[model samples]
Target: MNEQIVITFGNEKILTELKAAHPDRDLMMYQALSQPGEFMLLDHSGKDSVFKAPVFYDILSHSGEDKWDGFISFSTLDLNFDQQKVFDARINKLRTNGLPDGMHSIYSLNYHKDISQRIILGTWDDYADFELWKNSSDEFIPKEYRDSPNFYSHEAYYTPAKTKKTQ
Candidate 1:
């Protein structure tokens, strides 16, 4: 799975500033409203991601980060306050608990400009199982979204979650 940043934005001013800051970023900003707002930035300049899925390793794969810079995009609306806190703690927990450290990062894109979320730029490695991420063609289903999932619930987000065994 190619790693891309997910941002949720319904605010015009904040979204505009963000767009201006990183016009080159491979960003997927979400809009709750019916109309997609205009972007006041330059055209996309980076190579399109070569994202794929790992079917056999469905549960083992990661999407946030792998061997390179990557981001997990999502909406806060999907999670309640407690779930949000749990997610925040778990993501940080991943930085220290597992064999690999600093492998992924979770970012929320909201309409509130008061929140300080910056755009990150660098090479990103796909984290999710290639097959599993690819087989996710059911975007319209109640649970799935093309790439902008309202909430990112994966096996890696919690302990006891396993991964490919390196030899």
Candidate 2:
């Protein structure tokens, strides 16, 4: 399936390194309008295309993908250090135990700080699948992670209607 991914870097140094590492990859790089020095790299390509770049796994703290024209969702969680560890462990468990049903692709990013932001980007096979994953209870997620009062989560969903190509 054709895929769309968004990766954000906090500085030019990392961005430069990414460009140097993936000279042949097709990427749309732009500075964040609101956050100076922060760059966002967008790529739309075949399945698992982004995995070819070593820097994607190395420097990128935030990354997510959606199938072209399909359902995509993003969530940002703010958590403390202990909560972050629990969250990471839960994510690892989910990875090893298999993702919730209908999840096509999922990405977890932790922007470490006092109240770190843990962002999750996920795509589903269809709207129904997306709904299924969204409405699922704490059974799908770890209990401590779910019950944690020290964290806050915000989520948004998107469906692309058209694509604009710019030269």
Best by TM-score: 2
For model 2, state the Cα shift of residue 54 in Å. 20
**What tens-digit string does per-residue lDDT give for candidate 2 at 1-167?**
33234454434555555645676766545453334545544453322444333222211222234343355565777777776677777666666666666676666654432237666666666667867766775533456655777547776554532322322
Question: Model 1, residue 33: what's the lDDT?
Answer: 20
| Candidate 2, poorest ten consecutive residues by summed lDDT | 54-63
Which stretches of model 1 miss by more than 4 angstroms? 1-77, 98-123, 127-167
TM-score per candidate, chains pooled: 0.27, 0.54
Q: Model 1: per-residue lDDT, tens digit, 11-109? A: 455544554456556434333222344221211223432212111101112324332213222222344466445544544454345422233443332
User: Which regions of candidate 2 deviate over 4 angstroms?
Assistant: 1-41, 44-69, 112-115, 139-150, 164-167
Give the Å error, residue 60, model 2: 7.5
